[model samples]
Target: MAQLALDDYPDRYHLSNELHARPFPELTAPCRAAHLAIKQPRDAADRDRGRDFAHLVALLDRHGAPRPAPGANHYSGPLGRGFLKWEMHTEFVTYTIFADGVSQRPFSGEVFSLFPADWLAEAPGLVVTSCLVRVEVAGPDLEDRLGREVLSWFVPESLAVSQVVDAEAVVAADFRIDENGHCRVAVFARPGIGARRLGRIVQRMLEIETYKSMALLTLPTSRGVAQAVARLDGELSGVVAAMAEGGGQENKTLDQLLRMSAEIAQLSTASAFRFGAAGAYEAIVTQRIEVLREERIGGRQLLGEFMTRRFDPAMRTCRSARERLEELSSRAERAANLLRTRVDVENQAQNTEVLRQMSARAAMQLRLQETVEGLSVVAIGYYAVSLGTYLLGPVVEPVGIDKAHLSGLLVLPTLLGVWLMVRRVRARLDHGATH
Candidate 1:
């Protein structure tokens, strides 16, 4: 028979001897058995040769002498370095049993079963490590019997099961069963927004991801988110009311109430993330929505009060400035209208009268100036004639003339010339004024 190799077996059939040794009460007694001892090879070349063919002959010698079987069914094959081969009737069990003096860890006692006859038909000349077991009986009860024997190896003592629920229905659950069949069950807890019991319930629900996510699914109109924020706002309002009712006194009780209100506000804001999956953006949106709702409500409530206080100083300044400006403008306008009316009606008549009086004064002043100019011309002419006669005295004396009598004759002709010049100047001035 051809020797079998270790790698030729499938993963399920690698059960060690410790797993097969598990006592099963279901198996019948007095079954035929064959054993083959395995040894690790010292030399590298012979290691590939598998188990010694002589070992199989020896096991046959100990059990029952070798019979002249004509087919390959009577021979045992080889497994790898740490394994041994054994055949019992039509059944084959492989064991790893090298005494190489090295310490080894025990297998975990997990076993898997397979049909080798079917596998061998698929792959000829294949040496597989799987055991080929043939039972004498077959029925529907076989699977149950095998299952019972398999599960008896290792079983746990306890189990736990949990379920998560939302407003709609159950969302998720995890089951853990034990050998004793006892289960510890847990379910998600949800809290109402304004209920007195809500705080503790919310704290518990915050520990669970599914419950937190469910709590945050409010409509867009801020009704649900608003209610949540209002709960905190109401607590703050109560504190304010207490202080107001106490006549603005700083009461320690009211201060504590305010502090608690602030803490609840912070918690309510932080808890928005509990309504959705961890790290989900919806959780953040819900938190922002809650904040905005609070701002809107408080803003509308305080709108009038804020405006009233804010405009008081500016309003007073504006009113005073406006009144003063209006009085000044009214006085200025009246003065301007009075001046305009006077100028429009009587200004030309006053100007004409003043012009007529100035003309009469100017005419008298002109006549007086003419008379004075006439006298000045006569005096200048007389002086000039007298000076001429005096200059002629020297020349006329050489001709035996009288100088005084010639000056007197010259003075009359000078006076007549002066009078004519003065009259001409007066006529020019009068003609200019008429034009």
Candidate 2:
């Protein structure tokens, strides 16, 4: 199994895709040209040029842009949502435009005027807002003309001396412009814009994205759980129907039917339990989704407030659904346990009745055996007495004794012996049975 370390997760980047359609080619060009101009030192003797160069380097470092290599004239960093580092030099600015992991192209264009030191002195705190503006002009070469026109906003005086650059060039200029032009200019940054503030802005943007993705995951899970619950409910109905349609009330068949019914009941109970679990899960997911939605919306609002400075409406909704779901889960558990207990009690009662019936039948069989034994003794005693009587008749005839009176005497003794033997056997059997 491949394991992903926590540190290996990629940082999410959030940039609106629609912003790409705007004329970014007209925006980054002049910034690159200004960056180059500061490095080349047009006046090596001038202390101001050196100072401007140092300031430009500081700005680039603050923005996390790469420094030019030793004896190298230019450098570039990943730009526009792929690391997002835009370069501003004396001559021109170059920044890469990216969409879906692939770079559309590198946009490079020339700068018209460098921001003077006085401008920084006037506005101590400034924020950079890069806006991609779109325009249309009538001509076969309309796009090229529009690019030039947009670039002119940075350097209105240099249009006559400028060279026609590539069609897909990026122009970099400050948001500030002289009021004497048709194009609107905005200042990109003021003197006091610091790294810490930029980091906070980036963090807020990331938070917004995180909450949005969490919402997406949660809502779907809730829907899936709800669907599962519905399916289980249908299954439970079928189990109930099966149990109802089977045989009734004949003990042997009823026992089998009841067992089957119990099994179906167990299944139904299981389904109900699952349904409740799924419902609870769904409720949890819904609550999470709602919370995430609120977070996403709030984070976005905060980001907007940070960027534009405004208040957003407060979002507050109670989670009654979640509470209801928990209650439902508890109820389902109780219901299932109750059903199980009832089934167990019924099965135990049935078993007890079966044992009772067996015991009664065995007792009756023992009584019948005792009765048969007593009758056997009576029959045996009568036959023995008759044999004695016949034998005595012959013997007494030789002695001149009455045979009939001798037979009567033998019958009394035989009957008494049979009665005593039967009584003893019955008593023994009764004692054994009691033990």
The TM-scores, one per candidate, come to 0.20, 0.38
CA lDDT scores, all candidates in order: 0.36, 0.38
The CA lDDT at 222 in model 1 is: 30
Question: Considering only N, C-alpha and C atoms within 3 Å, which residue pairs clash in candidate 1?
Answer: 4-78, 212-274, 212-275, 213-274, 213-275, 213-276
Q: Per-residue lDDT tens digits of candidate 1, residues 357-395?
A: 999999999899878897798788988798879888888
Off by over 4 Å in 2: 1-201, 230-333, 344-367, 390-400, 426-435
Which candidate number would show the highest lDDT if scored against the true structure?
2
lDDT of 1: 0.36
Query: How high is the lDDT of residue 58 in model 1?
Result: 45
